[model samples]
Target chain A: MPALPLDEAGKYVAGAYVVFVVLLAVYVAIMAAKLQRIERELRELARFAEQRNGERERERVTTDV
Target chain B: MYGKGLRTLSIATVAALAAALSLIFFYAPLDADQGFIQKIFYLHVPLSIVALLGFVAGGVYAILHLRSGERRWDAYSYVCIHLSVIFAVGVLITGSIWAKASWGHWWVWDEPTLVSFLIVFLLYATYYPFRYAIEDPERQARYASVFAVTAGAFVPLNFLAVRLAESLVHPRVFATTAGGLPGSMMLAFLVSIAAMALLWVTLVKLELTAKSASGQLKRLRRALDAPAPGAPSRVAPEV
Candidate 1:
């Protein structure tokens, strides 16, 4: 049943495999973006907390002085 | 063990998946009999097998969590089952395409591939609503564990039943798939299987990481929201 560019059957078969690979790539990209965002947020939170603690310590030292 | 090891494991899994997929497309020979269409079988079969494996892994861990009262085990189990369902849906679609190409029909009622996978999809469908219905988190996990274990048991039984049915009804035309595959093709199958397994692990880790991060973020935000006398950024919740 030879027909057209790659044979209808063959094209469909190849397409099936292609669909999976494409879906996988999309999934990885989503995960990567998510991971980056989460890490960035966590870092921001860490810095904020550290700065707050430092300010609190400074105030305590000033009162003692 | 798996709780803290996710990061390194995710990288290694991605590498393994890449290697396995390379072997699938590059090293595997074209089938002498089924031609290009048989190639789909390489992916479809492995994905189906791995989906079953995913459910079973979830079931096993669910049992552990229920017995030991470990939240980590419950989380792992839920993630496993969830990803497996997604992957299984992929397999079902691709397999239907393959079957249509080979048999001149979109689906076959008696096809072992069609029947068994249908059973699994239905079984997994029930899992979500069942999980959502329960109010107590641990108790919900406990019931879900039981259902997942039951589904895990049925998956193999359905597979076996389909095989037996094929033998009795369509003995000549529906012989086992193993007879058709050659050595190179077999290698491809094995590689595909490995790749799918690695992909499953990688995907699960990524999802779990996202969930854990969000959970931690929620806690951090709550703590930040509390009236810390020196904190400056309590104006609004972090977007």
Candidate 2:
């Protein structure tokens, strides 16, 4: 097979690399979304724990009084 | 635990990929036959090779899962296959592009290698629906391991059949005998393969860490006697 002219061959080569880069970027974006969900959940869990601690402290104080 | 050393691994992957790309463009000589179009070979072939190996690795992990009855092995198998499927997609698209550039068509049934790869891709594509169909988590994981092992065995056989199918049109680029690839091309190809392999590992680790974190969250919620927030994942088995 004869060598393809540089300009023509360049387009296809560039397209292939671009596809690869775009796929990686998309995967990174997905990981970011997952990280966000984890962060939100952790925050909620922390708040829940704090509220539970406060309830326990208030009940102890009332019992002592 | 999965996240440990992730930063270093990612940095190494980037460095290797940079080296591979530079070597591909600057170091490797233009092919006498295919010229600049041949540059696609470095990317396409390495990805195909790594993805195929990944499928087999998934199968191996599946075997371990089955032997030990451990869910972590199942998680490992699932992630390996999942990433490989993505890699396979890249392979097929890039392969098609290379084929079109070389053969003047988007697809051709005549090439056994291309057709066989397509068949393999199609078979793996059924995995998601198959897992989703079985609602029982234990049963689903077991069945999936069986599928992974069966499919893993199929990979090598498929490649052998394609290789033997008598097609002189597709150049065997890896023919490493007398009058085969020159040293520079071989070096660049090896570097590209290393880069792709590293990239695969880094992404797999990233995904496993995310899944692990999710699992930890569920454990914490159970300890706190809190309600589960989201609908359970149908396809991905939790560790």
Candidate 3:
């Protein structure tokens, strides 16, 4: 095969590299979404635990009274 | 534990990738045949090789899963195959681009190497549905491991078959008598492979760490008697 002119071949080379970069970006985006979900769940769980603790404290105060 | 040394690995991957890109563009001499287009060879070949090794690694993990009946092994196997499938996408897209630039066509079915790779990719593509089809978690994992192992074994055999076939289009780099690549090209190629392999390992670790965190949260939910915020994933094996 004859070598493509540098100007023409540059586009194909750039396209291939772009494809790679885009794939990596997509993967990173997916991982970010997962991290966000995990954070939201952690916050919810923390609030639930805090609310439970508050209720237990109120019950102990009433019993002491 | 999965996240341990992740930062170091990520740093190494970035450095290697930077060096590889520099070497490929600035240092490596242009090919006599393909010229600038041959640069794609560095990316396409490394991604393909690393992805193939990943599939084999997935099979090894599956073997461990079967022998030990351990869920962690299954999780490792799942991540391995998962990343490999993603990498395979890169391989196909880049391969097609290379083909179009070199052969004046986006695809050629006549090439054994290209067709065999597609076949392997198509077979692994079925893994997601095949895994989800089984409802029971234990059964799903066990069956998925079997699929991974079978497909993994097929990868090498397929490569061997392609290697033995008469090559009409695709350049057989390794089969060349004058040594596959010039020294500068070989150096760039080797660095690219290292970068890709490191990236693979780092991503695998990142994923496993995330899964571990999710698993821990599930354990906490159970202990606290709290409702789960959403439906559990049907396909992902837990850490």
TM-score of every candidate: 0.79, 0.97, 0.98
Instruction: Please write out the lDDT profile of model 2 over residues B110-222, one tens digit for every residue.
Output: 88988899988898899889887998889999999999999999999999998888786776877746767799999999999999999999998999999999889988999
Per-residue lDDT tens digits for candidate 3, residues B119-171, read 99999899999998988889998999998899999999999898889874788
Per lDDT, the best of the predicted structures is 3
Candidate with top TM-score is: 3
lDDT (0-100) at residue B198 of candidate 1? 80
Per-prediction fnat values?
0.48, 0.66, 0.82
lDDT string, candidate 1, A1-65, tens digits? 22223387667777787778776777779878867876877777788888889999999999999
Of 1 and 3, the candidate ahead on TM-score is 3
Task: Write out the backbone clash pairs for model 2.
Answer: none
Query: How far out, in Å, is residue A49 in model 2?
Result: 1.1
TM-score of chain A, every prediction, order shown: 0.78, 0.92, 0.95
DockQ of each: 0.44, 0.78, 0.89
Clashing pairs in 1: none
Give per-residue CA lDDT, model 3, range A24-65, as digits (tens): 999999998998999999999999999999999999999999
